[model samples]
Structures are given as C-alpha cells and as structure tokens.
Target: MTPIESQWIERLKQLPPKRVAEVLDFVAFLAAREERAAAPQRLSDGLARLVALALPAITEDEVEDEIQAARRERRASQQEA
Candidate 1:
C-alpha cells in the first residue's frame, strides 16, 4: 500500500465502533456508485450527477492537447530515467 493510504488506515482504526461503521458504510456506498456508471444517471441524484457530468464537453483540439501532454510526460520520464 502507498504510505498515504496506510496512514489513513491507521487513523480509521482508532475511531469508535459506531463512527467506524458510519464511515465504512459511506465509503462502500461511494464505491458502489462508482462501480455503476453507464446506467442511466439522473441530475437530481446529487454527487452521482456531479461525478457523471464532471467530464466536460470534449472537442478535437482538447483531445489532441491531452495526447500531446501525455507524450511529453512520457518523454520526460524516459529522459529522467
């Protein structure tokens, strides 16, 4: 596990049972929602809609720009290595 993630685990272990249950339930609920995208999502569904819509309208230029950025990152990593 990553250091940051291990730190979170240690912190959660200290919580009271009731609070731990509440946190676990909330995390499970979020993970389930993330697992089920591509089914119909509704706007009134709060965070579900927000996550579904966070990817804004994509244009050809925007896609090209992301491709260029990825290539640059890869090249930089290779050079550093």
Candidate 2:
C-alpha cells in the first residue's frame, strides 16, 4: 500500500470497533461513488436517453419514496437477520 493508505489503516486500527466500522462504511460509500463517477460516458449517455424518454413520468416525489422504501426494506432485513 501507499504510505498515506498505510497510515490511514493504522489510524483506523486504533479506533473502537463501532467507529472503525463507521469509517469503513464511509470509505466504501466513497469508493462506490467514485466508481460510478468514473463510469464510461457511453453508459451515462444511455441513461440520459432513457431519462429523456421517461422524465415526464418519473417525478421527484417518486424518487424520494423509492429511497425511503429501500431504507425501510434494509432496516427490516437487518432486524430479521
């Protein structure tokens, strides 16, 4: 690993388990976001085409509802497991 990455790993190791997990989760989120951001323009162009076709039926409230529903599903699954 790079020096900076090794130092950050050491620092994370010193944290409590819960805090370490939080940091790891945030790191994972950032990595996934970066991956999405780095996707090929061709994929994004296709998404824009779809959006253009569907934007009239896809409202902001529907997006929010879908997010909330996903969160609820995750919580329920966590509780059950």
Candidate 3:
C-alpha cells in the first residue's frame, strides 16, 4: 500500500469500531457526492457527442407512429399467445 494508505490504516486502527464505522460512512458519502457531481458533466459530454453525429431529429408524428406500431405489435403477439 501507499504511504498515505498505510497512515490512514494506522489511524483507523487507533479508532473505536463505532468511529471506524462512522469514518466508512463518511467516505461513502464523499464518494457518492463525487459521482453526483460528475453525472451532469457526463450527460453533457454524451449530448455533445450525439449532436456531433448530426442525426436527423424525429418529429412528434414520427414518435407517435412508432408508439402506435409498437402497440400494434404487442396486440398481435398477445393474440398469437
């Protein structure tokens, strides 16, 4: 392990079990906070890549048509069953 990790381990070993548990909970909270902070950046990066692809946007009518087609397929499958 790294020196910092070793130091952390030594400090943790000196603490009571309850204190160690609290430290663990705090570390988890910090990690989750970091992930939450990164999520929006990740979403923005994904959207940028999608925009870079220059794909045509579907119209609302097209979306409705897809939904209707899916419903028709489901009905057909249910009838077959």
Candidate 4:
C-alpha cells in the first residue's frame, strides 16, 4: 500500500477495537454519501444524451393534451380496479 495508507493502518492498529469499528462505519457512511451525491449528475448526463438526440419540441397545447390523456387513463384504471 501507499505511505498514507500504511500510516492509516498503523494509527488504526493503535486504536481500541470499538474505535476501529467506529472508523469502519464512518468510512462506509462516507462511501454511501458519495454514491447519493453522484445520482443527480447521472440523471443530468442521461438527460443530456436525450437532448443531444435533437428530438422535436412539442407545443404547450400538446403537452397539456398528454397530461390530460395520462390523467384520464389513470382514472379509468382506478375505476376498473
């Protein structure tokens, strides 16, 4: 391992078992936090790919029609259930 990692190992070895476990838990928490932070950038990258495809833009009326159609379909499905 690198010098920094070796230093960290030495320090960890000096700690009590309970403190070592706490350090492990903190490292796991940091890793999970990083994954959560990356999610939004992943979504933005996907959206950028779709934009790069140069799809046709819809009018406001068309957008409203789609919303209404979706609502109607949802209502019909709920009623059938």
Please give the TM-score that candidate 1 achieves against the real structure.
0.42
**Which of the numbered candidates is closest to the native, going by highest TM-score?**
3
lDDT of 1 by residue, 12-36 (tens): 9999889989998999999888767
Ranking of predictions according to TM-score = 3, 4, 2, 1
- How well does each candidate superpose onto the true structure, as a TM-score? 0.42, 0.44, 0.74, 0.60
Q: Which runs of model 4 end up more than 4 angstroms from their true locations?
A: 54-81
Candidate 3: where are CA atoms >4 Å away?
A: 68-81
Worst 10 residues of 2 by lDDT: 50-59
Instruction: Tell me how candidate 3 scores on lDDT.
Output: 1.00
Model 3: per-residue Cα lDDT over 1-81, one tens digit each: 999999999999999999999999999999999999999999999999999999999999999999999999999999999
lDDT of 4 by residue, 1-81 (tens): 999999999999999999999999999999999999999999999999999999999999999999999999999999999
- Evaluated at residue 28, the lDDT of candidate 3 is 100
- RMSD per model, one decimal: 12.2, 10.8, 3.2, 5.0
How big is the positional error of residue 79 in model 1, measured in Å on the Cα after superposition? 70
Q: For model 4, how many clashes?
A: 0
